[model samples]
Target: MNQQALSAFIWSVADLLRGDYKQADYGKVILPFTVLRRIDCVLAPTKQAVLAEFEAKLAAGVNPDPFLFRKAGQTFYNTSKLDMRTLIGDPDNIAANLYAYIQGFSEDVRDIFERFEFATQIDRLAKAKLLYQVTEKFARVDLHPDKVSNMQMGQIFEELIRRFSELSNETAGEHFTPREVIRLMVNLLFVEDDDILSKPGVVRTIYDPTAGTGGMLSIADEYIIEHNDKARLVMNGQELNPESYAICKADMLIKGQDVSNITFGNTLSEDGHADAKFDYMLSNPPFGVEWKKVEKDIRAEHEQKGFNGRFGPGLPRVSDGSLLFLMHLISKMRPAADGGSRFAIVLNGSPLFTGGAGSGESEIRRYVLENDLLEAIIALPTDMFYNTAISTYVWVLSNRKPAHRKGKTQLIDGTLFWQKMRKSLGSKRKEIGDADIVTLTRLFGNFTEAQIATLFDANGKEVGRRMVHKGEFQPLPPEGGKIKLAPLSRIFPNDAFGYRTITVERPLRDEQGNIVVGTRGKAKGQPQADSALRDTENVPLSESVANYFAREVLPHAKDAWVDEEKTKVGYEIPFNRHFYVFQSPRPLEQIDSDLKQVTGRILQMIGELSA
Candidate 1:
């Protein structure tokens, strides 16, 4: 059966769980069992050989780990002769047999069940007199990789998790990101390194700090293998959610990756991969979530380690810790001398311009832009995630920028690139199509300014639309119609988003219009600035502060002077403002005519009523 059908079949087990298990608790039973069956089917072909190897090695008084792994052709093996089919044969002894089957697996696979707390679930099911039925239901489904590919199985897992999360009133997005989103991130992460990545036997490391179900890592691995069969991606990540961690580790195990690479813990407070650096990384951190829970640990690191730690640039306000993950990934980047690193993170619009000059958010932005590490930020369509419908942006950062990309950052307006989904899943009503993904990837790869133009006919119907590179001639508008243009892609120097906030002060004046002289030591006989008139102006980094104050502020306030001591460098990427397109409003005459037509019809109706 197909993935959707298989997922449906597995979800059917919930029918047996309804009265005994709360709707929210269905996943506690379903997810682990589904994983168990998948693993069971994977080892089925080699089960006999692995069991034989186990016996042969034990007889020789040698360790059987290597022999069993070789025999199973996987990182794990099951030693018990009781498969799910056989365990269900004896209805009364199913629970005891099921425990034995679970115990037969290697330590790694056994750990997965332990995290799932499968024993507790087993007892609960048996108490409800539902264990045998549930086990039998799962056993009937065929989840072999040959029948349902690994990619399909991954989708099935995510779908189940999404349903469970929704039922439990939890954010489904926390468990996994949409596949298309992961695909786009993977494409952006590897787009610029095609030459090196395409080389045969190319090996690289990919990590995700907020791994969820390892969607980002899995998709990246799939992307590399698709481009070059011999290319290999070693995946690693850390997750805070126990269930997600278990599922992610199981996924890696099934794909033959070392499950130990996926660690369980809060990435912010306890980094699982503290000693490792990766070549590529991707993450979609929880939006606007508070870091108050881990504030003590994070603040300690910032205060004690300073720049030697991940959060040294600056700490965002406790209300939103999305920037913390960005800083963490920044710290994990492989040095440019060691082939460097590229990463993409999904964030809300706040990080672009959340705090003012010298504030934590702005300082972080300043650090990134000043270092020329930000490569691009692509605005995604609203209603794209599973939980929240707010607009999001994907930031692509790299330390080893090419000559063409050095000192430059690209802003891609991809908000119009999504297609409506057939059915809404949570808050996700839109998805980026394969063609749109290609279009976006190409725009970033080209690294040039471009505009998307839409031509409309006389009836106001859209005739056509196409992307045109900067300096390229625009296509003529439809005859007797008009064309509208907006920036689809734009490139700017890193300094473009940076500015200096200069405090402007005006001298205090007395009632007689004389300068009010200060009586203090340093300010003796000098005019004191009026506190009420004090103002701040943001001077673009490209412009001299003195020149800007003279031309803009001084003209308006003749006695104004800049407070050099208060000058603070800040950065903000007003993404929408840069891509904004102005359109003149319709003429007053047109509005008047339309109103008159409606008024005349109303009068005729009144006259008919009078008659």
Candidate 2:
């Protein structure tokens, strides 16, 4: 059956959950069962062979673990004599049989169900008189790889989880990211290393700190395989949510990956793969969420490790932990001498320009840009997430910058590159289409300044749109029509986003207009600063601070001097300000003419009314 039909069939099992299970509790029953059935079907093809191998090895007094894995041709296998079909035949002992079936699986697979709290669910279902019926319903569906490709199955899994999270009023976005967004990120992550990735037998590691059901890792793996079948990716991820972790582990198991690589815990508090560095990474950490729970641990690391740990760069405010994940990914990058690493992370607008100078957020941005780690920032369309309708950006950072990209950052305005979905899911009303993905990917790959020209006809309807690169001829509209040009892709030196926030202080003057000078310490012979007259000015990093002070500050305040001690370097990508296009207002004559015409029309209408 197709994915939609399969998903619908599986979701229909909720019918048995009605009354006994609240809408919120339906997922506890459906999610684990779906995973169980999928695993059962996957192992069904070689079940007998695996069982025979296990028994033969056991009789021969040899360890059967290796033989069993080989026979099953998968990372996991089951030694139980019963399958889903057999469990249905004995309804009177269905609970015991089901428990046995679950216990028969390998340790890794068993761990997945344990985290799902499957035993409790089984007991709950049995107590409600729905265990046998639910088991039979799930057993009837075919989730074999042949019937449903891994990609299709992943989609079905995400869809079901999304529905369950929505019904339960949980944050669905924390569990999964939209596939299109992941695709675009994967594309950008690999775009610069196409040659190396396409090589035969190229093996690389990809990680996600906030794995969220392993969607990002799965997509990146699929992308590499699709491009070069011989290429291999070792996927590693860590997740905090129990259910998401279980699902991610199951996915890794089915894909023949070492499920141990996918850890369960808070990444910030504990580093699952402490000494591990990866070739690439992708993450969509919980956006705008606070890190207060792990503040002590994170701060301890920042203070004690100081440039030696993941969060050594800085820690954002307790209110938003998005930057902490970025720092974590930065620490995971393989060093440039060792082939380096590239990663893409989805972040809300806050990270782009959140805190001011010396603040945690600003320090994080300063660290990334000053070190030339940022490659690009793509502004995605708003309302693209399932939980929130706020603007988001995909930040691409890399330590192994190609010669063409070094010391330069590209900003692609992709806010308009979306199509309205036929059906909205939660807060998500738009989707990045395949064509939109291609366009954005091309812009990043090209790494050039370009503008999007929208051609309008004489009547002002949009006729066509085209992307024009710098130094290229602009596309013009038809006769008597106008063309609107906006920056679609722009490139800037890394320092363009950097600025020096200088504290400008003015001397305190007495009522008689005499300057007040400090008599002791550091200010011994210097003029005392007036707190009321103190102000700060942000000067672009591209310009000399001294020159800027002379040109802009001196003219306004002759006595204002830069307080060097209080000066702090900061970086912020004001994405909108750089691409803002200003349009002049209509002339007074035009406005007067329009007003006169409106007045005449109103007079004519009033005259007609009198008649």
- Alpha-carbon deviation at 526 in model 1, angstroms: 2.1
Instruction: TM-score each candidate.
Output: 0.98, 0.97
Q: For model 2, what is the error of residue 37's alpha carbon versus the real structure, in angstroms, after optimal superposition?
A: 0.4
Model 2, 328-352: lDDT tens per residue?
9999999999999999999989999
lDDT: worst 10-residue window of model 1: 168-177
For candidate 1, what's the RMSD?
1.4
lDDT against the true structure, each candidate: 0.92, 0.92
The best candidate by TM-score is 1
TM-score: model 2 vs. ground truth: 0.97
